[model samples]
Target chain A: MSGEASKAIEPKVLWGGGRSPFSISYGKIMMWIFLVSDALTFGGLLVGLGFARHAAVTKGFAWPSSEQVFTHFPFTHEHLPLLYVAFMTFILIISSVTMVLAVEAGHRMDKKKVAFWLALTVVGGAIFLGSQVWEWSTFIAGPDGDITTWADNATLKQNFFLPISTEGGHAILGMEGPQAYAMFFFFITGFHGFHVFTGVVFNFIILMNVLAGTYEKRGHYEMVEKVGLYWHFIDLVWVFVFTFYYLV
Target chain B: MERDDIIEYSLHSHHSAEEGVKLRKKIYFVTALLSVITIIEVLVGVFISRSANEGTGLWEAIKMGYIVLTLIKAGYIVLVFMHLGDERKYFKWMILVPYILFLLYLIFIALNEAIAVGEGMKL
Candidate 1:
């Protein structure tokens, strides 16, 4: 086919052959596709959380509010509701900003700026992960001590009491709590924390490459951009997680 | 294969100094916007008291507002931080539309199943 004839073909022909229809690199397109699937995975988890929460609340269970549960901040005995988690959210966001700055520097082929920003991104991710570990431990420990109890598993049916802290102390069945609340809290945030951990590793690897002048030798920094996409996706996921798990 | 021949690598050019300044400004603006929204959400979550059985409408309204604000934050992250906004229109929609539809379906199914479970328990 002549060039003129191919050019005259329908607009659908944009995806017909050798050229990239999306105007993005193959790596980038693949990254985005993976991100979309990842997002669905997270969405499923959140939706399940919503279902469990609704069922528990409708059954007259005074489901533990986030503000009530996440009241501990490091190095302080004061009752600070949701303060530490909010601080964690800011850490993730600042990491995201640094990541985008690295990508922008990549576009300009500014090796120094890119490395600086990428290092900051890694540090931010590490801090967030540490904060998550602290938060999870605090949650599991509860206000007084180990908050969950396991009961007899007779007839292959496991029974348990999931304690949520109230104004006075922990309570069991018919109290203000839902077992699934504690379960979902760990599951969803743990999942997002895993993402942050992965993103940190990825950013670290890319930062090393930048230090080694790999992209500089390659004449472009699309690798940085691809990893930046993943970093930002972590932050984006945290937005929803923070909103649903903490705020709502 | 050498990346020099790849269309994707060739697609971007170095930003001019002015463009760099503008991009930095936009990044700061988005960061500020995200921070403000987050602070507002935190304040609402902390300060607002929702008693066990009182002012149901206000609580619902606050919940809806929270969702909207969260969505706005998500949009800015994807569009600006992820640079999805710079991509082609079809590419943008291809990435966005599916998530929106899936989220709507998820919400519907979650509510439906939860209601069914609740009624079954009542019985």
Candidate 2:
């Protein structure tokens, strides 16, 4: 009956499936669809985080200020809030730029330039991952090495969740009141970090392909463009993660 | 490869040297723009105090500023870096509309949930 109805109506050829109306390849279109879905998943996690933070704030529970908790900079004794994260953000942005360059090089069939830029992108991704691991370790260790487990609630409460009023602001030094902050921090950034890890791996594989002249034989570098889209999506996700997780 | 596959593969030809240079320059400009915005965001986050009183008007404004700036950065990444801007309009909308609508819905739900939680705590 549905087929008869469609035959009677005979809509435009756009949905006839003989050709793509989008003028792009099927693979790229599929990539975009996958990315949109991934965006929703990440959005859900971030919104949940915001909800938790708001609830904590409403309950008069001191939320762990990003300034206080993320203050430690490597090899520096002084408190520096958001500096290391800014550095990592820059690294990711630069890597994104390199990825675009690689795609452009591929467009021109410049195999050498494509390999060069892809290698740089891989390095940048590796560095960002290293920074995230260091950050996770520092957070888990706590400032005074006191926040280990829930069993050590007595000392943990005193040392880790202290809400001391500092000269800068109302600083909640460690995990703060409910300890949900640390949990959210771990889960969200850990998820994004895992993406970066995969991105690095994918980029390395593509670079190897480029070096082996695989795309050269195929007469196109569409694989690089595809991976470049994924890489940029990773960077795009980081922009939101940085804003929600650290800045706001 | 199939005849259609051969025809569909990379319809655009290689860029000339000057065109490549121009493209690289645009990429650098975008990189610089993103970096500058990120630095501003960091400065605002670190220097601006969110006093003991949560949900002050000023703090809310700053939060909004962060979101707007992040959106701008995200736009550049998607449109320029991902080459979404170069695609046809229908494809662009098909890819972007769902994402925009979903994110806006999530943000709405988040705000409402927070408000409700706050009100509950008051009671």
Number of the top-ranking candidate, with TM-score as the measure: 1
Model 1 regions lying over 4 Å from their true place = A1-16, A142-177, B1-6, B10-13, B51-55
In the range A1-248, model 2's lDDT, one tens digit per residue, is 00111122233654566656555666777888898888888989999888887776766676666766677678776778788999999999999999999988887789999999999999999999999988877756645222232324443433445453465775534343447776778788889999899999999999999999999998878888888989999999999999988888
lDDT of 2 at A110: 92
What's the interface RMS deviation of candidate 2?
8.2
Models 1 onward score TM values of 0.87, 0.86
* Residue-level error in angstroms, candidate 1, position A12: 7.7
RMSD of each: 6.4, 7.3
- lDDT, candidate 1, A93-157, per-residue tens: 99999998888887778899999999999999999999999887765553522223222223212
In angstroms and one decimal each, the interface RMSD of every candidate reads 6.0, 8.2
Error of 1 at B57 (Å): 1.5
Question: Model 1, range B18-95, lDDT digits (tens) per residue?
Answer: 677788899999999999999999998888854442349878899999999999999999998988877767789999
lDDT for model 1, on a 0 to 1 scale?
Answer: 0.79
